[model samples]
Target chain A: MELIDNVSVAKKANVYFDGKCISHSLTLADGTKKSVGVILPSTLTFNTGAPEIMELVAGECRITLKGESEAKAYKAGESFNVPGDSSFQIEVTDTLHYVCHFG
Target chain B: MELIDNVSVAKKANVYFDGKCISHSLTLADGTKKSVGVILPSTLTFNTGAPEIMELVAGECRITLKGESEAKAYKAGESFNVPGDSSFQIEVTDTLHYVCHFG
Candidate 1:
């Protein structure tokens, strides 16, 4: 869906990589935590504490998980999984809009 | 309150000035429209079709409304208004977090 409904959104944003990445935290009705965010065209490494599902809403990116040599390209309407306590390098060719599900 | 509850948030972001400013559209249950956004440290001009109340959640900036000669400084917990069909110039010294209420 294009919209996430009935959630509480934090007014303050999570800014990272010098504002190359920006996200707003959300708490769903059942207490599920998620974030809607944007990543401008940039190559950045992100470390994860909780396993995450990066669901793309728009734009394009290439992702390389830690210890992986080959990069996988992902675009709008695609999703990628990253392991907990691991990291990934993402090269964004276009501005990326995504919802991150964390647990 | 620090959070806006029971609202629907658009997954896609509104990226402006090449990502210097970013915001997400939100719809309240009563159909009131609002946005939560971030503006990185930069000077930018914004035009308004609807009158706006920009409520600052954090950071600092100086604002000059359309046809105004003097700029006003605002910080966290402050707010500023801009009339419809007018514009404003904002010089952000620190990254800005805000909620825009439009009518």
Candidate 2:
């Protein structure tokens, strides 16, 4: 996908998950909010409030979405959607770069 | 500035600065590459190879550009530019979230 050319970033917030994951939120011009983060090598589960599109910018991970029978491997440029009110499990083999878009 | 709606992420890379900072690179659709990173509370100096616009995505930091006698405080939503081949010093009082654009 091609994003627009101009962007205004939001104030920084320090979100730490036991030193495993770190991320900050950004607000777009139209007021759309998203987060960019990095995840270290670990297994983690996340619950979402809104439907989310998780795009992998770097590294690799195996993800098991809710109601899915098996985990799927996703690398950079790949993304998965998680329904709101559901949960997903992700296993990171190395550092992972990701952007989460909530809709 | 508003970024475009779609973007393809690049593979992740683990960049560690003696545990003070970590970041990964992403490539935009136009093949423009940028980096997102977090800096811990410390003072650090960096030399740049390309002209850079450092946007503060979160937190606060003080920066001293090359040839500058006094450092300036920049909070989230602010940014500073550095000329290529020059160096700058940054003092982070809190965890700093930043994205760097190379031109």
Q: Give all candidate RMSDs, comma-separated.
A: 0.9, 5.5
Give one digit per residue, the lDDT tens place, for model 1 in A1-103: 4899999999999999999999999999999999999999999999999999999999999999999999999999999999999999999999999999997
Residue B63 miss distance in model 1 (angstroms): 0.3
Candidate 2 recovers what fraction of true contacts? Answer: 0.13
Error of 2 at A65 (Å): 4.0
**lDDT for position B21 in model 1:** 100
Candidate 2 lDDT tens digits, B1-103:
3332334333343456553676645556587877767888889998889999998877789999999999999988899999999999999987787888889
Candidate 1 chain A, poorest ten consecutive residues by summed lDDT? A1-10
Model 2, A24-99: lDDT tens digits are 5556657787777778788998888999999888789999998898999998889989999999999998678788
Give the residue spans of candidate 1 off by over 4 A: none
DockQ category of candidate 2 = incorrect
